[model samples]
Target: MGAATAATYFRILTEGPHVHRNLSTPQLVEAALARGEASLAANGALVAYTGSRTGRSPRDKFIVEDEETRTRVDWGKVNQPFPPEKFEALLERVVRHMAERDLYVMDLFAGADPTYRLPVTLVAEYAWHALFVKQLFIRPEMSELASHAAEFTIIAAPEFEAVPERDGTLSSTFILSDFTRKIILIGGTKYAGEMKKSIFGVMNYLLPERDVFPMHCSANIGPEGDTALFFGLSGTGKTTLSADPLRMLIGDDEHGWGPKGVFNFEGGCYAKCVDLSEEKEPQIFHAIRFGSVLENVVINARTGEPDYSDIRHTENTRAAYPIEFIENAVIPGIGGHPKNVLFLAADAFGVLPPIARLTPEQAMYHFLSGYTAKLAGTEAGLGSEPVPEFSTCFASPFLPLAPRVYAEMLGERLRQHGADCWLVNTGWTGGAFGAGRRMSLKHTRAMVHAAIDGRLAQAEFVTEPAFGLSIPTSCPDVPAELLNPRNAWPDKHAYDAQARLLAKKFEANFAKFDALESIRAAGPRVSR
Candidate 1:
């Protein structure tokens, strides 16, 4: 293909010896099927398997350690440093590796709002990956695509393995981004999420420069045009809670709060499907259809139906489908300024109230802390125990900037909009995971409704001494006792012990955050 047209869209595709331009979804699906990269499941969804690596390899991700990005990024374990020359060499190798192969390319937009949207060109060695991106990002009209220029480019080559020694990489798998060059390189992994997250990372880096606060959250709108933002790390019910049948979903995972309003950073939802039930998550369960891509999900060989309970492949089973797949999704995926911003946590310790209202300072503190429990098996290291982990901004791994960059933006927006903030625990009750019962979805829904409908605001608030959270004395449909953790626990002393331990953990974690003493003081204090 000619370099002029492809290069204008993405320079990386032109650098590659061969470039394929803008293949239709049907054409790409055919190419994927012919190459045996994907197969049609019994349910008519595309079944793709990423051998060995089913989830994102966060440790393998790196940012170019050059003049342009060296000072810009938070360089350490999470944002590892990769030599610019090494990145150049890797790019050359990646380009050459795909030179002889039939490549697939698609140009799409990232942000849904026109003001902040980024034109992205996705270049993939696997046709299925191209189709996946097409579904996961905003598709441009034919006329727009003709003259579309990509602000960023992604070149994914899963078949190309890096040499750790030669490439100066930790392993054969690498996901490196060079902001100065506006290009991202992926190799040695077939997990489609890597591609999805890399684009979000690019936005996380670029948007803040333009004063946009990019978020790892879900957003939705009520009929009265009121908007709400749900912030949480994975396994925290962001997708499930945001997909309310009574509300219109703006987007499920990534979004940007800019001058205009809250806009979806992605065009689709990549929902975790472990133990997903049709009755529990009806919207997500039904969104799996003909064009959906089922990643690492086990399917019955005979029936062709997905066995969501099967962890043989991975606990990180996922489904990727367009946002429109959800029945009540907001077309164009945009929403007004949020009236409420919720910080969701799955507190396995069960010491936190099922729901609590947050002051502005507490909101900033919690937003910065991004505290949540890490369930075992989510990573390689833990046993079946629940461990507390802090992911700053609910997306520390994907954040290229310092935590304060996002936190400060959030505080400013919340104050500017006069938005109410909340902390809701969708975890265990009475005791820790093993000793306690998981909070019922019915009760959680009722509590959220109360928060949104102004019922919780009118209720009497009693401050939880250990956590310094103002828990409501009663909610509309939720029981009075469930509102307070101490009341819910049979042994108040045991609850006090767990509360103290959790408060200490929060203090220790917040010490790492170099913010003003006032913002730091916004955290919890355990009363003796």
Candidate 2:
């Protein structure tokens, strides 16, 4: 069984009496309510719960090691190899399970740009999952839907649990992708993010072959037509910072850098809702309305309002809404080549500069290192404290190919386009997580605006010895002492010790990457 067999199964399922194809938002929401899958919030947003699993199960994800991907895919812990035979069997089981239930199907586009957009078909077992993807992915016009044909299909049966012994899965939940068959199979977990990110993984593998650099970053454009990208992992402020009221947001996450320019890989945003407030993030707060889907957010039973502070379910609560819900979002989500690129790091160790300008080599080094403290609740097994780790290109989980593929592509694009690069630590400051406070959002925003608007370029710079990053002497609307991390720390010796430890971590991580001498030399100056 292969692509042809998979296609035949999908056609049978779609044409079956239990199938509901292309249901509108209202109809899907109604269906979800009737099925008791979700409830309506006071603000009219649909609130759903992902029982047991609140975040992605990376260990459970597998990519088929068929003849097509045998040499192309990077076979390791991240891209775990699943036997082609096992995948076909698992897919058959999932399809059979879905065929017995009321299936909801949605056809959507992944990329905003027509030239590179991927036509996707999602076969879901729940109506809310259909609503979730409908809002998260680009919706086509009525006329376009008439001729729509999916290049890839995702068969998701959340209620259908896999038999680990027979399916070769670590747990009951499984996310299996077969590039040769052009199909993704998901089961056991109801977390809708698996569906969204599976497509992202596909794009990450497909686009680079087409000379397009697929990025896991947020993008926005200024009034002067200058576009900027914010690269970071979840809970790193990529979505919060890019939703600038003054600029038009291209997308919150997932984009492609092609010959035309930067284009959004999604039609909407999936923003973290932990401690979310209108006063802090007005755009995201307001964007949650009638058509949006809120996952695991605690709604007050008495008032029906959402309590963003509640973490009983999980700290990784989320809100998904169309980009148009944001008043300043750019329709079609296309922009000119970025004038600036910022690498965001949540340094829980509190040693990195508040903001620093990166030379091309330094940019490449950090891009490969992609160091950031893994915040709690962002993933399933993470502890409460922020753990320091390097997620290559800030997107190791989604990349099916090797890290070098993305890094080389980024280096080429930055050189050809001459985009300015900066490193901003949106993490802790002064001491560490428990000892020091998180960086001020206002101050971070001021520094970001200064860097992108060309104000910080004229400021004097001092080289930090630990990471060899150029720290600006001053930034408008930011305190002078706060620009340097050592100045804010009460115990300078303690700060130095932490810096040395982090520098060693960087050195150890970079040792594995086979990069140019200059790129390797750009890493931290670890003093033994």
Candidate 3:
């Protein structure tokens, strides 16, 4: 099997536990095989794996396929409607073929070993292609790609080729740039490496300059044709907040900004699926009904479908697929100048003001201070407490451009189109999330509704003490009880203490950018 096969197994591993839950053994098997075939077809088997043999690896272990013919271009995956009930039919065929031929499948990460009655190795084996494509779209760099490899090998231009699987050797992509490539073996997360390679192969020599800059943001286009950009690090509710009923979601993560406007680099959205509650965020919950790709999510034992609100199995919960998976996902996932830009921060320290209309300088300052809480299980301790962390631009690790470049582009776009910018805190209301309490989803939703309806535009405002930000006293139709931080603070002292600490954190986090004050933005953060 090729990297395409790796993708098939990844689907099985992530949504595997759910595939046969509602069905019997025969039906489940059929569904599994059918799902695999559909994935291969939908992900573009006709294009990706079709190149002629180019060369062999230095070890003579693998062969590199044709690069020009390869679909280095983009492809979309409508995962849900594919193969449909034919899963049972395809399952019946694969089982009979494998069993009749006495071919025992080796499952790299088999859960309880499949009942196929054949020898199975429950190891971790997911494809590196998807991540490669994602990397290419978001952060295409040879050195960056190498750092995500299987064995931590250094990356260089094509010097060696990959051998084929039938040669009794492993054939993988080393680096994606110059025709020559080899696969690295990532133990637990096997897919990140190959995915990075395929992505880089696209612009290896094609583009004259890397003008497109990758951003950690969600994008949406309003009915009025204006796009609203939401930039945040993980956990600030970018995915949850941007899935608005009134607008079209361009994409949830990873956008590429160019002269044409902002285009979502990813065909899909990588959402934080941990402990997901549909009732709380009905829009996101409803988006995953079918055809959406589930990644590392835990399913209920009985239903075989995802239990979004449950975070017991994993904290690094995610899903990947074309934006169309969501009912209102934008087709091209690109849009023009945004009328509104939001910088979301999950302020754990809670010292920052609730909301502020930022100046371009302040916007850049907060954009680089991407703050949020880590999911409980993603770090060292599982079923334990979450740790709050901050990353510049909420994307220092994976962004394709310098922070100034992104900020400049954002400023220019907003200035050119006359956009309004806001720094919204989604972290904590009282002291901090773990120390105090998380702001209610209802309240956040209410605030968003108010903003959407223009109810808060003329609301009473006061300059926040710490950041000198404007805070609105009330939003129309929202409860008076939920307007300010004090309402959520049972102990005012704790709230004040946490807020100060959080502000200090931001100041320290932004110390690196003190020298970039002279950088010019695309436009002022606020105003026409």
For each candidate in the order shown, give its overall lDDT on alpha carbons: 0.89, 0.93, 0.48
For candidate 2, give the lDDT of residue 274: 96
**Of 1 and 2, which scores higher on lDDT?**
2
After aligning candidate 2 to the native by TM-score, how far in Å is the CA of 357 from where it should be?
Answer: 0.1
Order by TM-score, highest first: 2, 1, 3
lDDT of 1 by residue, 164-261 (tens): 99999999999998887888899999999998999999999989989889999999999999999999988889999999998999999999999889
Model 3 misses residue 90 by how many Å? 36
Q: Residue by residue across 162-219, what tens digits does model 2's lDDT show?
A: 8899989999999999898888899999999999999999999999989999999999
Predicted structure 2, TM vs. truth: 0.98
**CA lDDT, candidate 3, residue 10:** 34
Which residue pairs show collisions in model 1?
none
Pairs that clash in candidate 2:
none
Stretches of candidate 2 off by over 4 Å are 2-4, 375-386
lDDT against true structure, model 1: 0.89
Residue-level lDDT of model 3, residues 199-317, one tens digit each, is 22222222213554456678887777878778887678899888877788987865655556677655555566667766676666655533344544555456566655665544455
Each model's Cα RMSD:
2.5, 1.5, 14.7
Question: Cα deviation in Å at residue 9, candidate 2?
Answer: 0.3
What TM-score does prediction 1 earn? 0.96
